[model samples]
Target: MLQLYGNPRSRAMRCLWMLEEVGRPYQLVEKTTHADDLQTAEYLRLNPNARIPTLVDGDLVLWESMAINLYLAQRYDGPMHCAGPEVLGLAAQWSFWAVLEIEHLLLNFLEHRALLAEFARDPSVTERNELLLKKPLGVLNDALAVRGYLAGNSFTVADLNVAGILMWGKMARMDLSAYPELTRWLDACLARPAYVRLRDQARRK
Candidate 1:
């Protein structure tokens, strides 16, 4: 059986969502960020970085949430793969693009609002994030406007990977209202039963 390590509320949620989409039975070994368990010898052996989300399938131990999801999609989503090589590459592109291009600014504001509240608040910083986000958001909005999903019309791993990152932006209160297409796309993607099931799982104790 596949053993996925980490709390459903963390980055592991992405993998959990993917697992649901894969329609396969797997075990979720929950771990909390507050606990020092991540640094424990047992956990560190699976992921040297001591990350909350680690995937253990047979002898293949994997960390990094995006990579794990990609692996899952490629490995289990089809007899060959749910997505072809082109879509697979697009999945990697969008996932990497989200972290590198979009998440930096979103996380900056999230750090200020969620994690570093002790620091003086600056509305300008968040406003700047909103401003900085316009270009990428516009690109996504335009793309989603033309297609039902990121890679093509059909829902693919790219949608899950990219939308998962965008969902983080939404949670961080990025106010994507200006990009209606993007907002609608995200709403549709997140409305999937798989994502909803993951949310319910996260709410569990």
Candidate 2:
């Protein structure tokens, strides 16, 4: 059996959702940032970076949530799997875009707006990030408006990877009403049964 080491509240949530979508039998080992589990020698052998997510399957060990999800989608037979090389390329494109263009800004916004304590929170930071987000969000909105999905007509790994990052936007209570198409697409993606199952499981932990 495959073993995934990470806490659901972290980026591991993305991998967890992907595993659910792949319908694979895997064990979640549950390492949290708040604990020393990720720093231990045992965990370090799987991921030298001491990251929250590390996947172990046979002799293969993988880290990085996005990479793990992409690997799972490519290796497994499931709905999230890419249909072809072109689809895989597009999926990789959007996944990288999500991390590079949106993830940091969203994380900063979430921290300042909600995650941080009231006294520690910075309205200026949130305002700046919100402004920065408009451009990328508009780009994403336009893309979704064209095909309803990122890479293909139907949902695929591209949608899953992008939506996984955008989940933070919803958690931060970011106002996305300005981008109706993006809002609709995100809502539908998050509503998928596999995503719902992982989300509920995460909350229970």
Candidate 3:
């Protein structure tokens, strides 16, 4: 059996969604935000980084949510998995592009505006980053103008990874009226039956 240790509200949600998409039975070793559980010697042996999401599949131990999703995709040969080296390259490209273009910017906004106390946060930092995000967002919006999904025409890891990263924008509550194409694409991604199951399962846990 596969054992995945992490809370659903965290990055592990992506992995959970991937698991559901693959339709594979697995155990979710649900965890909390407590340091005691995350930093235990036993847990550290599986993930030296002491992260909440550590996937243990028999002799294989893996960390990092995106990589874990990729593993599941490849292992099960799901539709999200790349069909060849060329397609795999595109998946990798979109994944990295989303992280570099939007992930950190969204995190900056969340940490400054939502995580920190009002007195401790520097609104200027979040505001500046928010402004800078428009360029990359515009690029994404344009790329998605004529397509229903990223990478290829159908859903794949490229869409899954990029959509997961872009979801932070929804959390940040950024005004997205300008990116109609992006908004349309994201709505479709989040509306997937697999993603819905993932969300409901996480909430129940």
Candidate 4:
């Protein structure tokens, strides 16, 4: 069985969400971000970077959340694989876009608000992040305006990947007043039973 290592609250949630969407059974192994735990030799051996959401399937070991999801979809599942070019062109498109444009901007704000709270709280950085966010949000608003999902017309791994990162902004209480379309799209995505279950499960863990 595939053994997933990481807390659900972390990027591991993406993997968890994918597994649920694929309807595959896997084992969940919890890890912590605590300094001591991260520094342990055993954990370091599993993930040299000490990051969470590492996966061990047979003798294969991998980290990086999105990559794991892509691998699973490609190897274990079919069109569900967000990485496949032919089956889910848009899936791959939005996945790449989400990581590059959306996640990059979101993380800028998150890092400022989280790891670098003092620096993030700086008016200059906050202002910059706030400004950067509008561009991507606008793009998303326009894309979702005529379409219910990010790829095709139905839910795909692309939607989950993009929406998963966007939910961070929502949790941070980021301003959404100007992006009504984006807000509406996000609401609709989160309304999915899979997403709701993932959110509830993450909260519990």
Query: Could you say which candidate leads in lDDT?
Result: 2
Candidate 3 overall Cα lDDT vs. reference? Answer: 0.82
lDDT, candidates in the order shown: 0.81, 0.89, 0.82, 0.77
What is the per-residue lDDT of model 2 for residues 120-182, given as tens digits with 9 covering 90 to 100? Answer: 999999899999999999999999999989998998888988898899999999999999999
Query: Where is the poorest 10-residue window by lDDT in model 4?
Result: 78-87
| Count of clashes, each model | 0, 0, 0, 0
* TM per candidate: 0.90, 0.97, 0.90, 0.83
Better of 1 and 2 by lDDT: 2
Put down candidate 4 lDDT per residue, 134-164, tens digits, no spaces: 8888888888888777766666777778888
Q: Which stretches of candidate 2 lie over 4 Å from their true place?
A: none
Error of 2 at 53 (Å): 0.7
- Can you give the lDDT of residue 196 in candidate 1? 88
- Worst window of 10 by summed lDDT in candidate 3: 73-82
Error of 4 at 159 (Å): 0.9
TM-score quality measure for candidate 1:
0.90
